[model samples]
Each structure stands twice: as C-alpha cells, then as structure tokens.
Target chain A: MAPLIGVVEFPGTNCERDVAHVLEILGGRAEILWHGESSVKGADAIVIPGGFAHGDYLRAGAIARFSPVMTAVAEFARGGGPVLGICNGFQVLTEAGLLPGALHKNSGLRFLCQEVALEVVGTDNIIGSRLEPGRVLHIPINHFEGSYVCSHDTLRNITESGQIVLRYVDNPNGSVGSIAAVANIEGNVVGMMPHPERASDVLLGSTDGIDVLGSLIDCLAGDTEPTPVDQGH
Target chain B: MRFDVKVEVRPRAGIADPEGATVGKALRALGFEGVGDSTTVHVGKLIEFDLEAPDVPTARDRVDAMCHTLLTNPVIEDYSFEVIPADSGSGD
Candidate 1:
C-alpha cells in the first residue's frame, strides 16, 4: 500500500496543493488536511507547506500555531512520525515551539524570489538522511522574512547535536551559521526555508525534491532510520 | 470600570533589526539635528484597546498575559504596556 501523506493547509497557505502534487508524483497518497481539522486523518506522515498563515498578522505563523490541527500534528510528531515544514510552515513550527529558532525579516529588507544553492551538511534528519553529505541542491526561496535567528546557546546546541540538516552554499538570507534547514534531536520534525515542492519538475527547473519527499515515504514504510554517520563537516 | 491599555512591542536588544538600521540611516542622511551617525532607531508596534476590569491590577494583569502570549514573540521581541483608566480624559 502507498504511504498516506497529509498536507496541512492553514488559511493563507498557498503551497499545499503544490506539495501534495509532488508527493503524489513520488508514489505516495497525498491528502489535504485543513488547518481547522483537528485530526490528521490517520496519515502516515504530515507536511506543513509554505504560505502566510493567518495572513501573518500578529507575526508569521503566530495565530496559525493555535489552530486545532496543530495540536494533532504536535501529537503525531511526539510519537516520532515524520513531519516536514516548508517556508512559512517553518515559521509556524517555531511559533508553536515544535522547532527551535525564529525567522525574521531578511536583512536586505526586500522579498527574495529566486533559487539558491544549498549544501547538505548533516544527514541527521529524515530528509537529509536520504541524500549524501556535501551534496548541492537548488531550491527556490520566496519570502520577505526568511532570515533565521536563534540564541547563541541554541546555536551551539544545534551544532553539537547535529540537528542542522542543511546549509546555504552562499548564505542568501542571513540565516545564522548559513543554516537552511533544521530538525529536532530525534530528527523526526524538520523545517526549512526553501520550497522543495517548487523544484519538482525538470521543465520548471529541478527535481531534487523527489528525493526529499521520497525519504519521508521510506520512513513511513519503516525502511529507514536515523543514521548517525558523520558527514565530516 | 473601563481601562485604556496601550502596548508597545519591539525587537529584543540583541536581535538584528535591519528595519531600524535603515530608518536610522535615512534620518542621518536627512541632516536631522541630534540624530547622530550611530544613533539607534527602531520601528516598533503600538496597540491600544479598551478593557472592562474592576481595578487597575486586574486590567494590568490581563494585558500582561496578552503581551506574553500574543502581543510579543519572546524569541525575538520584547514588550511593555501601560494601563490607564478610560474616564480620566487622558485616553491618549
């Protein structure tokens, strides 16, 4: 049976379907889960795609973090289920305290809408585990507030724990340590500023996202685990 | 009793505030007196509302809770608020 992947959609989220389309193309059953819905509908894995949830009113992902669906999502994540957050979804996870660090306005003070070069630094997370270390990926990042910031203590912790999943090759958005993605200690919940779904088709540009989403499917099928092999960064 | 509550939210001390830096630079370029080259300027938020509470402490406590939860992101921002009785004719 194909793995059932739940794509969560908050009110202002615009990338749910795009993420779902990519997952479906990768041989997983994609289901759209509304933010209002409290349950994940028995999904084997969950995804929070990017967009301005709750119109980013109080702050990006501030109000959306309180939505009922997030409660269920947190519960699923606590059980070690795989969860991925992209762009604005990453903001929500931080506001909800599911992930560490907060994303602030880009230092350039302008919205960036371009593809960036990323290097896989640590394979501690499910997505990074699927790809080889030091591999370069081209992903699109479209956001005004994509700069990542955290306390120095948190930075040291993430570095020592190997929770950093990805880093920018050129540090476009001022993310600390040039980090582009991160995961928890267990490597089950991961968040990234880039939009992997937007890189699905070769006609559009790149298809590097297939491997990222495919890794989630493999984890759901119990075909993969947290491999502690050092990437020797 | 009604209380007029005003809340101010700003980026934390060490957080990088590019918006603030940009405004400070613009002010310096415009030759504003007393606005030095290194003067710090920050753009923050102000929220005001009318609340019904029995006493000053009650109103203050309510607004404080709001600041801790919704009005500020503790990870990057800090907040302060003041509560004044609405009927004193100093609602500003």
Candidate 2:
C-alpha cells in the first residue's frame, strides 16, 4: 500500500500544501489534518510543516503546542510512527515535549531566509538512514527563532546517543553543536529547521531534499536500508 | 476572591539572549552614558493575569501552573510570579 502521510494544519500554517504536494510527488498519499481535531486519520506518517502558527504570539510554537491535534501527534510518535517537523513545526515539536531543547531568536537577531548548507551527521534515524554521513545538503531555512538551545546535560546525552541528525555547515543560527536537525532518542520522530520539502525539486534550485523525504517514506514502509536517492547538484 | 498575578519569564543563565543583546548594542550606539562593555542586558516577558481563587496559596499554585504550561518554556526560561489580593492597594 502507498504510504499515507498526514500534513498537520494549524490556523496560520502556510506550508501544509507544499508538504502534501511533495509527499504525493514522492509516491505517498497526503492528507491535511486539522489542528482543532484530535485525531490523525490513521496516517502512516505525519509531517508538521512550516508557518507562523497562531501568529507565533507567545513564542514560536508555544501556543501551537496546545493545539488539539498535537495530542494525537504526540501519541502517534509515542507509538513509534514516523513523524517529521520542519521549521515552525520543529519548534512545535520541541514545545510539545516530543523533542528536547528549545529554539531561540537567531544570534544575529535576524529573520534568516536563505539557502544553507547542512551535513548529515546522523544516519541511524529514519530521516538520515539512507543518506551518507557528511553529505552536504543545500536547503532553505526561513525563521526568526531557529537557533536550537539545550541544557549541557541534554546536549551531551544527545551527542553520545547519535540523536543529532543534521548539522549546519556554516552554523547559520548559532545552534549548539551546529545542530540543524535532531530525532528523539527512539529515532522515529525528527525535527529540522531547513525545509526539505522546499528543496525536493531541482527546479527549486536543489533536489537534495529528496533523499530526506524519500528516506521518510521508506522508513514508513518498514524498509530500514532503502536505496539512496540521486544527489543531483 | 480576585487575585492579581505578575509573571516574569527570562532566559536561564548560560543561554544567549539575542534580542536583549541587540537592545544593549543599540543603547551603546545611541551614546547612553555609563552603558559599559562589561554591562549586559537580558530581556524577558512580563505577563499579568487576573484570576479568582479562594486564597493566596491557591492563586499562587494556579499561576505557577500557568508559568509551567504556557507562560514560559522551562527548557530555556526561568519564571517567577507575585500574587496579591485584587482588593488590596498595597503589599502584605
């Protein structure tokens, strides 16, 4: 069966359609799950795409974490279902306690919107399973609060466990250890600041994200060693 | 009884506060005297809320829950609150 990927939609979410479209293009069925709802429609995988949910009022992802659908997302992740969060979604994940640490305003106090180079630092998780460690991916990140911060103990724990999945090649936002993406200790739930869905097409300037998205689908299909996607420059 | 609460949330020690740093830099650029390089500012949020509770302890507990669940991110922020009787004009 084709994997059913659910894209969550909050009131102010703007990237749900982009994620749904990209998932379909990658041979998966896509559905948009509403934030007010408390269920996930039995999706095989979940993607929380980027946007200023709830206007990022209290803080990025602070209010969104209380959305009704997030309870379902957390439950889904706890059941070992594949879950991916991008940009604003990443913030939501951390706020929801599905991931450790919190994202803060950029060190330069600027809302960065540009392509950044990322290195695959972890390969044990679903998102990085098929990609080679040290592979450079050029993906775009658009966010004001994207710098990830964590306690020293938490950093040491994640580093030792190989939970840090992606690292910024240029350290764009002052993330600790240059972390651009991370997974739960279980490696089933992943959160990343860079927009892999936005980078999935070559016409969009790079196809580097195909590997990330494809790896997700493969993991959902119960394939642990899926073939790597072509890394088109 | 009605209670007034003031919740202050700030980044924890050892965390970088870019917004605060930016404001401090601007203060120096604007020629604010005595704003030395050794001085640093940490910006934070002040949230005020009014609630009805039977007593001060109950009000404090409720406000504490609010800080833990919504007003602050414990991972990066530290929060404290003051609760006072709404009908009182001064401190206890």
Candidate 3:
C-alpha cells in the first residue's frame, strides 16, 4: 500500500503545495490538512511545510502554536506517527512544545536564503534512520529565525540519546552546536530549518534532498538500515 | 502617574551576537573606552505609561497585565518597570 502522508497547511504556509507535490511524486498519497483540522488519522506520516505561519508577528512561530491543526499534530506525534517539520514548521514544532528548544533570530540578523551543507549526526529516529550517520547533503534554508537554542543539560541529553538529527557545516544560523535539526526522544517527530522539499528535484540544482526524503519514506515503511548513498557519512 | 518600563532582550547563550560585537568595536574606535566593553543587547521600547484608572495600584495592575499579555514574550524576555507617582520626582 502506498504510504499516506498528511501535509499540514497553516494560513501562510507557502511550501505546503510544493511538499505535497513532492510526496505525490515519491509515491505517497499526500493530503492537504488545514490548520483547523484535529487529526492525522489514516496517515502513515505527516509533514509540516514551511512558511511564515502568522506573518511572524510577535515572534515567528509564537502565534501559530495555538492553531487547531497543531493540536492534532501533537497528538499524532505522541502516538509514534512519523512527523517531519521543515523550516517554519520547525519553528512551529518548538513553539507547540512537541520539540524542545527554540528557534531564535538568526545570528546575522538577516533573512538568509541559500543552500547549506548538512551532516546527519544521528540515525536513531525515523527521519535519520534512512541516512547514515555523518552523511553530508545540501539543502536550501530560507529563514531569519533559524538558530537553535537550548540549555546545556538538554543539549547533552539530546546528543547522547542520538536525537540530534542534522548539523550545518558552516553554522549558518548560529544554532547551538551547529544544530540544524532534531527529533524527539522517540525519533518519530523531526524538525529541521532547511527546506528538503525545495531540493527534492534534480532540476532545482540538486537531487541530494531526494535521497533524504526518500529515506524518510522508507522509515515510515519500517525500514531501518541506512541506504547505500547514506552509508559512510 | 508615570511609569517607566525597560525590556532587555539578548541572544541566548551559544547564539552569536555579531551586531553587539560590531558596535563594541566602533565604540573603541570612537575613544569611548567604557562603551567598548558593552556587549550587544537589543533593548527595545522605553515605554512611558499614563493610566486612567481610579488609583495608582489599579493602574499598575492594568499595565502589568498588558506587559505580560502583549508587551513582551515572557519565554525569551525579562522586563522591569518603575511606577512613579506623577509628581514624586518633579516638583509641581
């Protein structure tokens, strides 16, 4: 059976359609779920696409945390369902408390839009399960508030538990430990500042993201071993 | 009554503060030795308040509520305020 992936859409979620299109291209039945919805039933996996959820007012993801759809996302994640948050969606996840830490203004204090090289640091969760530890891939990141911040003890625990998913090679946003992404303790929930959906196509200057997204799909299907390209860093 | 509110927000630890560092360097160039030691902190809005409530205590409560609910992000920011009697510091 084709995997059913839910693409959640908030009011200003600009990447929902692009992510949905990519999932469809990858052989998943991608459904658009509105922010007012309350469940991710029938979904093998779910995605929170990137965008300025609420005009970034009063803080980037602050307002979107109260959306009805997030209530369902939280529930879905708690159930061990595979959930991925990209860019702005990543911010939303932290604000919703589904993920620890927070995304603060970029250190440069500029809205950066560029391709970044990321190294997969941990592979215990669904998102990282398909990728070998230490594998480097290029993904585009466009955000002003992409830096990851957390307490020292919390960072140590996440790192020791293999919850740290991705780290930027150049520390584009001044994230702690160059942390570009992380998953929950269970690994079912992942949030990343880079836009994997944007780089899923080869014509878009890189097909590197395809393998990452494909690995995510494979994980949802219960696969655990890292793919060939993902082997050896 | 007049109220003075100061909100100080800084990048959390491990987060870079290039803006603050840059200003510190500039201050040194300008020969302001003490200012050179200042780390970059983004402080915003020195808000002055004039309340219409019946009493100072009542007005203070309203302003405090406003600060919590809208004036600042409680999770990332810390605020301090001085609620001074309208004529306490200045002779009428």
Top-lDDT candidate index: 2
Q: Write the per-residue lDDT of candidate 2 for residues B1-92, one digit (tens) a residue.
A: 99888988988878988877777888888989777552268889999888999999899889988888888998889988899899997665
In candidate 1 chain A, what residue range of length 10 has the lowest lDDT sum?
A224-233
Better of 1 and 3 by TM-score: 1
lDDT of 3 by residue, B23-85 (tens): 677778888766635455343335565555656787678777866655554444556665666
Q: Summarize candidate 1's per-residue lDDT along A49-138 as a digit string, tens digits.
A: 999899999899999989999999999999998889999989998888889999999988999999998998778787864788889999
Off by over 4 Å in 3: A223-233, B1-15, B22-33, B36-40, B44-76, B80-92
TM-score of each: 0.94, 0.94, 0.80
Superior by lDDT: candidate 2 or candidate 3: 2
Please give, for residues A65-173, the per-residue lDDT of candidate 2 as tens digits.
9999999999999999889999999999999999999999898888999999999988888787569998999999999999999999999999999999999989988
**Candidate 3 lDDT, tens digit per residue, A1-233?**
66778898888889999888777776666899888887775778889889988887767777887888777778878988888999998888887788888887787778999999999998887776457887898999999989888877889999899889999999987898999999999988889999988787778877667766776777755533332332211
Ordered by TM-score, highest first, the candidates read 2, 1, 3
Give the winner by DockQ: 2
**Cα lDDT over the full model 1:** 0.86
Model 3 chain B: weakest 10-residue lDDT segment is B5-14
Candidate lDDT (C-alpha), each? 0.86, 0.88, 0.77
Q: In terms of TM-score, how similar is model 2 to the real structure?
A: 0.94
Off by over 4 Å in 2: A223-233, B36-39, B90-92
Candidate 1 chain B: 10-residue stretch with minimal lDDT: B33-42
List-wise, what DockQ does each model earn?
Answer: 0.84, 0.86, 0.27
- The segments of candidate 1 whose C-alpha lies over 4 angstroms from its true place after superposition are A223-233, B37-39, B89-92
